[model samples]
Target chain A: MKARVHIMLKTGVLDPQGEAVRHALGSLGFDGVNAVRQGKVIELDLADGTDEATVNEMCERLLANTVIESYKVEIL
Target chain B: MKARVHIMLKTGVLDPQGEAVRHALGSLGFDGVNAVRQGKVIELDLADGTDEATVNEMCERLLANTVIESYKVEIL
Candidate 1:
């Protein structure tokens, strides 16, 4: 089984990397890019039948910094 | 309109970050975590009706390192 965790900055959190990417896009002549938020995706290949609860626990424990980020887990 | 781009390394490429994370997880006592691949997700808030072609071009030009990575674009 596979589990994918997407971790993203929380709303109102400052994202300098995302801002830099947005500026780079403007300089590259791509217009109308209103906002950009950069996040991380962790793809985990686990033993079969690894339950969702464990994956969620992984997210809560290590995959995300809950102080300023949120995460979602998807089983595939 | 919004667009989400998921960029991931091509198979066979060495991902030191992913490996480090895996090792860290093992040390943290999370067993059965066979493999992990780390990637980036870029969420774009765009002008209404911003077409997919434009978003794809952004991926080719700036969002992804085409040499060692592949990207998927999702419009929302």
Candidate 2:
């Protein structure tokens, strides 16, 4: 089984990296890019029969920085 | 409207950041975490009624490093 997890800063949190990227985009001639919020993607391949609870545990334990980022997981 | 884009390196690509993260996890007492692949998450808040085609164009033109990362978008 494979799972994809997305981790992102919560709303109202500061994102300096994202701001830097936005500035770069403007320098590269992309207009109207109002904002950028950078985040992380994690791909996991697990043994068969892994439950959603286990996946959540993985996020809580290792996959996310919960103080700043929240995560969503999709199993396939 | 909002769209979430996930960008990741294709399988077999080197991911040094993920490797570092995995090592950190081990040092922090996580067990059985064999591998980690790092990628990016982008959140776009667009005006209502934005189409997927436009989103795709934004990604193709700037949001991804097409040489290495592939992206998937989900609208909400």
Candidate 3:
């Protein structure tokens, strides 16, 4: 089984890296980029029969900082 | 308009960060994790009429390093 995780900073949290990318884009002549938020994606190759609950646990315990981030998991 | 970009390291490239997370998972006693690959996602809030082409150009020019990574763009 394969699991895909999308981890993103919560709304209202500051994202300096995203801001830097937005700035860089403007400097490169790409206009009208109003905002940018950077996040991460983790692709996991799991053993078969690994259920969604286990994936979620992995996220809560180590993959995401729940205080400032939120994550979505998909099984494929 | 909003655009989402997913940037991932090319297959066959070494990813120390992913490896580290896999190790940590094992240490914490979560088994059956065969492999892990880490990537990034960037969400861009753009002005109306910002098309997919523009987003792809951004990726090509700044958002991703073509030599080592590939990116996907989705307009929403």
Candidate 4:
């Protein structure tokens, strides 16, 4: 089984990399761009029998830094 | 209103950063870690009237590369 996790900053957090991308996009002719914030995704191929609780635990334990970000998991 | 976008590589795509992170985790004493794939999350603080279709279009056009990645949007 496979799972996809998305980790992102909470609102009001600063995102330097996304800002850089936004600037880069403007230089590359992407107009009307207002704002950008960057986050992370993690995909996992888990052993069979792995359950959602374990996955959520993983997110809280190591996969995500709860201080600045939150995470969502999608099973695929 | 705010929307969060997650961008990630499709299955079968290579993820150098995730591999690097896995290695780093191993060195940091995170055992039993088998695999990792990295992706991106974007947060959008949109105007009052922006719709989901437009947000998705943004994902396809500039927020994500369809050639290598897919995206999801969340409203908060």
Q: In candidate 4, what fraction of native interface contacts survive?
A: 0.53
After the best TM-score superposition of candidate 3, give how far the Cα of residue A74 lies from its true spot, in angstroms. 1.2
- Give TM-score values for chain A, per-prediction: 0.98, 0.96, 0.98, 0.94
What is the Cα-based TM-score of model 3?
0.98
lDDT of 2 by residue, B1-76 (tens): 7778888887787989888877876787655556778899887766677788877877788888788888999887
Cα miss at B8, model 1 (Å)? 0.3
Report candidate 2's interface RMSD in Å. 2.5
Which portions of model 1 show Cα errors greater than 4 Å? none
Best by lDDT: 3
TM-score for every candidate vs. truth? 0.98, 0.77, 0.98, 0.66
Predicted complex 1: CAPRI docking category: high
TM-score (0 to 1) for chain B of model 3 = 0.97
Is model 4 an incorrect, acceptable, medium or high docking prediction?
A: acceptable
DockQ each candidate and list the results: 0.93, 0.48, 0.95, 0.40
In candidate 4, the residue pairs with backbone N, CA or C atoms under 3 Å apart (3 or more residues apart, or in different chains) clash, namely none
The residue-level lDDT of candidate 2 at B17 comes to 85
lDDT of 2: 0.79
What digit string (tens of lDDT, one per residue) describes model 4 on residues A47-70?
A: 676677777877887788899988
| lDDT string, candidate 4, B29-59, tens digits | 6455588888887777666677887778777
lDDT of each: 0.94, 0.79, 0.97, 0.77
The residue-level lDDT of candidate 3 at B5 comes to 98
Q: Which ten residues in a row have the lowest lDDT in candidate 4 chain A?
A: A24-33
Task: Give the DockQ-based CAPRI class for model 2.
Answer: acceptable
